[model samples]
Target: MHAGFTLVEVAVVAGILGLLALTMTSAFEGMEQARQQNTAQAHAEAARQALRTFMLRNKRLPCPDNSTYGDRGREANGAGSCPGDLRVGWLPYESLGLQVPVRSQRLRYGVHRGTNADLVAPLHGAVDGPDLEGTGGLARALATAAQAAPSTDQPHYSGAVPALSSDTCASAEPVNPAFVLAAPATDRDVDGAIHPGFDGPNRGFATSSPCVAPPARPATRIYDDVVVAESATTLLGWLSTATR
Candidate 1:
């Protein structure tokens, strides 16, 4: 054999090194993603707790911001039930008056009372929670107010009424009073829409409409959504001291 290896041999060694580097890169990415997801979950819990605090202080949940995220109260009357076409929109981060929960420190919140076209975007293809559809899910609980007994309380709500069924839209008395939160992380593609989905391991979100719930699908370009939800019973339970 010659004193030194041929060009082909050196090429083979370089290729092997390249492949090894790629594998390590992918592994690191996976680990970072797991960490980010866990962090997002913690943030959601914090937001939920903050919401409870707001209710304790105000005796009622804050309304959706009229234009988009932030702001507070309602659009039509500045108080009472959220008013809008679907009554579904981004969460009132400023309204709730809670510090941003993520280390990145950005607004990551969404809510749906009844109407939010994006929640069910690609409506037919997207999967909806059995108990958390915009119409059949959170919206249904809200509908309870319509059929519920009138309120004697000053804040004035329908009080308790029957919850709605996703399939039949039937009532079950004492609606659960749940709502959806679309808390996506940051923008990845650099496109204006920053709903949810990871450009890298650093991104995470509570939920991004059209994908809804968990098991976010990257194939559908609907990854990075982290949905956090609460029922009226659980969320407003604190109200017992003030309202009940």
Candidate 2:
């Protein structure tokens, strides 16, 4: 008998080798994805902690439900509104001395608000009625100054509020919900406007009918991968206080 390996034996060996290679490849991919998810979660927790600290100091939450007083748009007289600026990236966190990591992608921050018009004005203070009581000292000051000079015609500072239907927090008109943190998935329905960081014009994120887009490609922002699931998409702070 010829001392040669049979064809069947060779085929079996080849099949086993292929299976081993596939298993290794899958394991590597899974590990990478897990690592990414962990990193994103860590960032999220950091953001939350920063906001909590801000609340402790300010006697109110960093991103108030119905106000944009401390949002990125008004940061450091607009110095922190740049895309790479740590102030805008982390919102109120930056002021607390936290340094956001410089990842391949940027993060977006958002605020949580209710549908109450009186509480939160729509369109960055557009509907902010007269501060008759002068509750909002800043708004009152702006109103006083604007009235002093008729030629100035400067718009009064309005409170930040959502302009969406009561049924859905999504805005029927173009309005920017203050971002508290960056999201992971781009395809998710984003209710807020684009940050001045992302918007070339002064306006924040623009509006789209569907309000959902494809998964932000790798080059987008790091947090673009972190999506807010529809069921749990309500503002975290709001959820904490809900009766349910």
Candidate 3:
């Protein structure tokens, strides 16, 4: 009869197999994470381009998709206007004519929805074409509010306190938020727990909303959402070059 393997040899073989399994698992997990990140980036980029195109064509930005007013992706009021109180909501993908499904549309969008400076206000509504004043009033309004002191008029997206009127904390401040698009990361570390970076003040009403800057705070914070903002400066600059 042939001699069989020793006990230690069996144990060593088992340990090696275990290590191999662990390595394979880790590799798969890493691949999944990368895939999720890539998909999130692609979605954000596509949505950003769509928002810009819509603004260019309509001369006004479409409101976020508030659910009560219409379908899952349509504007709250069917292209008329967003509810004054609903500052943050889902991106109006359908309203923007986007093909993203309701189930896959996880992007949260927020805009400066002030009546005085409504970014959703139809600048082209006037028969004269663009705003009635014929001045760059629409774009100017957003710029003014974004630069003003922290208040209902200003846009915010993150946990940091809004900067003082004169203070310049470029890194901590939320300066470029004419509108913001936030996508929650797929890897929820806590599994079903609400993440502040994904559901916190940044996605709330104007009075309570915090300034938005992505990879949000708490040094150990996991699953930080991806956020992209469109600033008034950029919008105005684009408008300046448009064929209006």
Assess each prediction's global lDDT (C-alpha) against the native. Answer: 0.40, 0.34, 0.60
Candidate 1 structure quality by residue, lDDT tens digits, 1-244: 6899889999999999999999999898666656655665666667687766765554344554444333333322454544433334445565666543332333334333332221212122223544222223323333343334422211111222312211121222222224444444433334333433432211322222211332232311223434465644454344434444
Candidate 3, number of clashes:
7
Best-first order by lDDT: 3, 1, 2
lDDT of 3 by residue, 11-118 (tens): 999999999999999899767756766676678778889988887766667877766322477787777656767667678888787875544336777777654667
Choose 1 or 2, whichever is better by lDDT: 1
Model 2 residue runs over 4 Å out of place are 60-93, 113-180, 183-224, 227-244
Q: In what order do the candidates fall by TM-score, top score first? A: 3, 1, 2
Per-residue error (Å), model 3, residue 169: 18
User: Each prediction's Cα RMSD?
Assistant: 13.2, 12.6, 6.2
Candidate no. 2 TM-score:
0.43
What are the runs in model 1 whose C-alpha is more than 4 Å off?
69-86, 100-177, 186-211, 214-222, 236-244
Clash pairs (backbone) in predicted model 3: 156-210, 156-211, 157-210, 157-211, 157-212, 158-211, 158-212
Total backbone clashes of candidate 2, pairs 3 or more residues apart or in separate chains: 24
Q: Candidate 1: deviation at residue 36, Å?
A: 3.0
- The true-versus-predicted C-alpha distance at residue 166 of model 1, in Å, is 20
Question: TM-score, each model?
Answer: 0.53, 0.43, 0.73
Minimum summed lDDT over a 10-residue window in model 3 is located at: 162-171
